[model samples]
Target: MEALTLTTPALLFSAVSLILLAYTNRFLGYASLVRQLYEKLKANPDQVLLDQIMNLRKRLYLIKNMQLLGVASLMFCVLSMFLIYIEVFLPAAYAFGLGLLLLIISLLLSGWEIKISVRALDLHLNDMEHFSEDNS
Candidate 1:
């Protein structure tokens, strides 16, 4: 195999940075929503609200894990670059491969989270449809 170079691992920097940025934005949005729901629950908790809260809790955990894996991916990429700088080509390649795998895992988790989000929204739409039908 050809020797690993710092540029090879550096290619991941922008992609990883963008991913982390998006994850951070998602986390912040969830945090705000949770606080709003918490206040509402404090005043008057209902079954629907309770269910939403539970859903949000699961989403938050998933986001946390996604972020964790994303950061780990970034860390490994940096480590790989450093190893390459020191002429440790074999270890650098291994580290780069691990970093890529972790990135893939993070993306998969993101996709799962999106699927759950869509399902949650579908429940709301279904409920709205039922309410309209009952009125008719």
Candidate 2:
């Protein structure tokens, strides 16, 4: 049986691709959340709705940073791939690792953003319930 040996460049490319795929998936989920938030806003505007908007804006800023980081990471990954032709494995690995780290950071930021959004909605729901009780 013959075993296939994967080159360093190939391994780095694989890792970078996986990170990009995961990042893309995270963005899609965020987009869906944004849509839901919009629908909630259309239903009514209250302190909770205001909070959601503020939270969304903050998350959008993070998304911008994530995009910027992703672009830089891609550039580094490409450079590292080229370096591999010179048999430089360590540097390529480092670049690929940086890209993965950026992706993980973006994912963590997204999770925080979602938590803020949920909390804002919860606050709004509680306020509405309280107001209804006051009228009873």
Which model scores highest in lDDT?
1
lDDT of 2 by residue, 1-136 (tens): 2221235435645665665576577667768877887898789767765766677678667666666666666676676676666667677667666766765675676577668767767887898999999999
- Give candidate 1's error at residue 39 in angstroms: 1.8
Flag clash pairs in model 2: none
Q: What's the TM for model 2?
A: 0.57
> Which lDDT tens digits does candidate 1 get at residues 89-131?
8888999999999999999999999998888889989999999
What's model 2's overall lDDT? 0.67
Best by TM-score: 1
**Residue 55 deviation, candidate 1, in Å?**
0.7
lDDT measured at residue 82 in model 1 versus the true structure, 0 to 100: 92
TM-score of 1: 0.94
